[model samples]
Target: MSDWGPVFVAVVLFILLTPGLLVQIPGKGRFIEFGNFQTSGASILVHSIIYFALMCIFLLAIGIHMYIGSYFFLNATVTPLASSSKSSENHFRQALLTFSNSKPTNTSFLSLTQIGKETTPSDRRGCCGVVFVEKWLLQRQDWRGQKMADWAPVLIGVVLFVLLQPGLLFQLPGHNRQLEFGSMKTNGKAIAIHTLIFFAIYAILILALHVHIYTG
Candidate 1:
């Protein structure tokens, strides 16, 4: 996919997922709130989270992953050859163990400080690969390595949204105890359902297109 592909997808998601993106008043579609309705911070939080999850899913579907640090730029310009998505080097976790597996071992766990003090930088260099731990290995870009990467941000959003409820935290101007979009007054339930539907459609469309953010 082109560099602008991800950017375009991001913009499309923002428009579709943003609540009250289009608002109209004094028109045929104008809506009126029947109750002392208002959207709490919790509602907004939920919507935000839903948007995030959908974005991740969409990106994953399109093979768009965020490279850490300067990896993306360096890999693009510096690396002569693209690194394999798989790492074929020794396990970094084993190196961290700092113990023998074939012999008897101590059960005691080392503190972070002790580990930090014991850990020394590797003097090893790579031919064309990046040195992870002490070995020249490829960066992992496969789905297996990032199975739960989506959960971290989603969980944070979920927790905040849940707390936003009951008390209706962070009452802003537009959502002042009521939720309405354009001429259509809405509740959290409706918003949540529509968000899910939007996600489904976007996901299907992305799958149909089979777009990838990067090659190799």
Candidate 2:
């Protein structure tokens, strides 16, 4: 299969997974809450189950779409590519290029950092290829004016995961209080691990289905 489809899906998933991107860091100025409709632990557990179930259904749909839309079903069994790395690299390069060419709306918070700094465009591409090795792998992207620590993305992921869990909701000292939903607070490790596992499983399932569909 081509890289674009996988790249597109990865980007979509990233957006879906990181709803906290808009949120401000703990304390710089006014803080913004990330999510809405905070629920009890029981409600959250149920929601989690439902969320995962729907994700499975979505994966099934993707497999079916691949089989029907691609030449895989009609042709003899062919081994699927071992990974999505090439596709990911290409897309990241494209992203950097887009960031480079576009006029900056926010000079303070560009979408990509180190654009004109460290390396030339060609060298940057080479280095960035290593950095963005996988879709879920978090190398810092610009988030407002804040300089996210290396583990910041992981923390954001963890925080979001915690918020989704059953919890005694405390009114966090931020912009919003009376209404539940507070600013983003996450555990970096949890999010990183979750992303790695989720994407690994997803890639495996996709490859398996790709091979199985063609072989059968």
Candidate 3:
């Protein structure tokens, strides 16, 4: 799994480095060229920064999902002592009482009470003896607001990813490697490759983010 992580990262990087895809902002009426096209030094720097920032965000999200998914998966498999014990007690009592009475009415009472007791509010409320009642109570207090709150993080992430330019993290490798606008040398081929990589990554992340925000 760990080996796969780095391999996946390399593949993503390679896709991002491929040349020649252009995107146009519909409302702005401007073309953002990708993949081996002639472009100004300033334009190259801005695009590079944007791509880098989006890549970092996508990596961070992947890390977070992995961590949270593991936690939930482990937690779900374990049973709590309190609930298990309570269930056994109810069953045993019902069995003993049913045999003792031997009447249909008494048998029905035992069955109803036993099942009801097992599933009562207090018994079914915790996760592996870890009490979630307080959390549940708190959520109820602002349930509507809490439901809508899910969109906030997704919205903010989308806004940041779109607004920021790619490749902000570092200068494009094999290029001039300079910090300033004039110092960097813009190779048409390299720029095109980088641009293509950026757009591909951008499209994938956006699709993933959309699925997450909507499905979650």
Candidate 4:
């Protein structure tokens, strides 16, 4: 698989995890509704799932980028690039030194760096883990109010959530209510915890995958 295969999965995960896809604004008692049929609680659980999944997917992506960058760094030292030529060695050394002096910073508390970019590097790889993070989190620190284009991930997330809906149905067993899934009641706190656990499981799964790839 390519490096981005995992990323694609992560993106899908982000999209699926987008809250309010099936149920918008649960706080207002407005769940999934179509015509005279309506359903509740199912969307809350789904929204929770989405929130947690997004957190997990991004965390996993960060780890993968770091691991891949580390692999690249280790490979650079012993591979032909660094070992075969004095010029390459000098480049690697300079890159390393520069990286040491200007380490990357976390770009956003909500996320690591942007999905698929590294901000800076001493060599062509630049510092795989640092650049985007540095640029996003550190240099351009006003992350709370980014431009609309910058919110592409979030917007894409919403679209993905809508696309993942199983289908509209009127078979649910409530009075004039139809549901997307098994009926279940939830509150903000419960939904929050569910999302957290969802992301936690996802993070572990990706870490396992990362280990397999790294060792493979």
Candidate 5:
């Protein structure tokens, strides 16, 4: 099977397993009440940001792993050569020539060519072919920036949550009391739990991204 098959499957599974991404909007009976029983938009917005950020992280990890696994499978199935030593040597030389002569303008395009040319029998057959194999592997481009892009949403969400905390607190029905930074009235427990939740979600997102990118 091609690498894309497993990648597609993983992506679908990840999406299916994560439904919180779709639960951002307010629903019936899911309202946050402030003083005088008024609904708080700020509270809803803060919570939404937190949830969305977490969702982005989860998806990112899934993508990273999928790509990594796919690369492994492709590498394992590739055979260098099966003919006589001389013939294998000649083929390897030809394959190397083909790879060297081809100048890829972009990373993705170059990777496709490298994968196609290096996995063939001529270039990959014997134990001594390890160096060639490693060279081919190294030719693939890094997608770390892409992974970071996937994680950006989650980071933004965390920032938004922190910045809107004051408004969020005001929206709470019983938490209207404000405490000084050094005051004993501060609800450290609430703050801590909220921070922990965001971190946990971010971790999951990162894991998912790793899985997806690698497998793909």
Candidate 6:
């Protein structure tokens, strides 16, 4: 993924999260339909800033998710943690530091992804516990499976952002006084339709921006 992925996520998350916040594309159409002639303005700018700040936050977090599955199998493993004779937890930190240029930071969050990439056997073999001479990377080329597994972090992050939205964090100004943007307080066909429409909007923006949620 490129920088655009975070930007797209930030924008969508802002529209979905802010209470009573109706959004308009830069050129047209109100998310809350009754608003008159929506265009770029303070409300939109502020919301953008809010989500961009939140994107910066996506880079925070000390990475408590330390240990992945142990190197009990040769069908997996990366160079860093695999490099040492013993697959200790500290080596993972060493790998992270190497990839992130000695230390992880908000800007280098994506560097962590490099640790799990499938490598050529020469790069991977003998690093971990693997004694095999056969190409571990080539033996199992499950492209679909690999991509889906790789997508977990992105999916989990998006789900967390969406799930956190309904708690009414703060009151923000919007065109709607009577209608809530995404209230879980009630269940109705209207809510279902609203969700579908929002998803459609998500699809549209994603297509328009040519955003790739995962590039590895």
User: TM-score for every candidate vs. truth?
Assistant: 0.27, 0.25, 0.27, 0.25, 0.27, 0.24
Q: Across residues 1-216, which tens digit of lDDT does each residue of candidate 3 receive?
A: 011232244234434432222432111224554443233434534544554555455544543222111111111122323446576445444544443444222112212122233343544543222222122223223534343222323343334333222333332443545332332233444444544554455445533332223222
- After TM-score superposition, what is the CA distance of residue 87 in candidate 3 from its true location, in Å? 25
Q: Write the per-residue lDDT of candidate 1 for residues 32-80, one digit (tens) a residue.
A: 2223233333334555676667756755554454322221111111121
Give a tens-digit lDDT track for model 6, residues 1-216: 122343345445645534333433333344443222233333344544555456545532321222223232122233444344345344444544454442212122212222544444543442434322222222222434342112323444354334333222211222344345432232223323434544555445443443334434
Overall lDDT per candidate, in order of appearance: 0.34, 0.34, 0.35, 0.35, 0.36, 0.37
lDDT of 4 at 6: 41
Q: Candidate 5 residues 1-216, lDDT tens each?
A: 022322333233322222122232232356422222222344355554545544554545454333333222112222334444455556456655554554331112111122233344534443243332333334233433222333343444444344323224321112444332312111333344434454445345444443222323
TM-score of 5: 0.27
Q: Which lDDT value does model 3 have at 88? A: 45
Q: Report the lDDT of model 3 for residue 183.
A: 26
TM-score of 6: 0.24
TM-score for candidate 1: 0.27
Q: Is candidate 1 or candidate 2 better by TM-score?
A: 1
Summarize candidate 4's per-residue lDDT along 1-216 as a digit string, tens digits.
123334344444543333433334343354443222222445535664665456345543343333232111111221113223454445445644544344222222211111233222332342223232233333223556332222233333333333332222211232234332433332333334333543444444443433231110
Candidate 5: worst-modelled 10 consecutive residues by lDDT: 105-114
Off by over 4 Å in 5: 1-129, 132-186, 209-216
Which stretch of 10 consecutive residues in model 2 shows the poorest summed lDDT?
72-81
Q: How many residue pairs clash in each candidate?
A: 6, 9, 16, 9, 40, 1
Once fitted onto the true fold, the runs of candidate 4 whose alpha carbons sit more than 4 angstroms away are 1-183, 209-216
